[model samples]
Target: MKDKLFKNLLHNAKGYSVLNSGGQLVKGYKPDTVLQKGNEYIIMECDTGTSRKGYLGAMLKAARFLSNEKKGVLVLVIKEKPNTKVKQIAEHLQEYLIWLQPLTNLNIVYLIESNRYCPDENPLELLSSEFITTATIIKSD
Candidate 1:
C-alpha cells in the first residue's frame, strides 16, 4: 500500500532521462520530477534508508555532472523520517552540498514521508515539511 501510494504521487514528475555511454539509462538515478523552472532542475533519489558518506558523494558526483550540462537543482529525497535519521542525513547532505554547489547547478530537497500534499511555508528552509514548497513555487510561476 505504501509503495503504491508513493509511486502514484511520484509519477507526476517527468524530465529528460539521463543516458550513459552505452546508450542506456542509469540504473539508480531517476529523471528530474519537475522540468527546468528558473534554470532549476530537481533530481531526487527517493531512498528508503539512512544515507552514508560514500553513497551521498557518489550520488552528488553524478548529479554534479548532469547539473553542469543542464543547469538545475539536484535533490536527494529520503524516506527515513525519524528524528535522528533525518538529522544525520541533513548534516551529510549539507556537507556534500557545500562541495557540489560550485561545480554543478544542483539544488537539494528531501521529502521524508508523504501521504498527501504537505503544507509549509518553504520546505527548503524547513526540511521536515510534508511537501516540497520549492517545487511548488517554481511550478506555480
Candidate 2:
C-alpha cells in the first residue's frame, strides 16, 4: 500500500522528467526515479528501510559520475514519519552530502520525508523548493 502510494506520487511530479528505474531491470543499483532539471540530474532514491548503506553507496557513485557531466542532487525520500532510525539515516546522508559536495561540486543535497507532502502534491515541487532555495542562496553569494 505504502509503496504504491509513493510510486504514484513520484510518477506525478511536474517540471521534471522522472525516470522510473525501480523496475530492477539492472542489477545492484536501481533508484526509484532520476529527475532532470535544467543542468541538474537528481537521483531520487525512495526507500522503506532507513539503514541501507550499501544501496546508498551505489547511488552515491552514480551521483558522482552524473555530477561530472552535470549538476547532481541525491534526493532521498523516505516513506515514513520521523523516527530514531530515520533520523540516524538522515544524519548519515548529511555526512555523505558534506563529503561528496566538494568532491562532486554539487549545488545541494535534499532529504525529504514523505509525510511533509500531500498525496495530491507533485513530488517535484518539493524537490524544486529545495533546489530553488539553494540556488537563490548560492547566487546571492
TM-score result, candidate 2:
0.63
Q: Write model 1 residue lDDT over 25-127, tens digit each, in one string.
A: 2565444343333444444444455447644764565455555457554444455456435447665566666666666655554434322232332223222
Lowest-sum lDDT 10-residue window in model 2 = 132-141
Q: Can you tell me which runs of candidate 2 are displaced by over 4 Å?
A: 10-15, 23-28, 52-55, 81-87, 120-124, 130-141
Candidate topping TM-score? 2
RMSD of each predicted structure: 7.8, 5.0
Tell me each candidate's TM-score. 0.51, 0.63
lDDT of 2 by residue, 29-73 (tens): 566666666766666656666455743574476556554567655
TM-score (C-alpha) between model 1 and the true structure: 0.51
Query: Which has the greatest lDDT?
Result: 2
Residue 40 CA displacement from its true place in model 1, Å: 4.2
Error of 1 at 117 (Å): 6.1
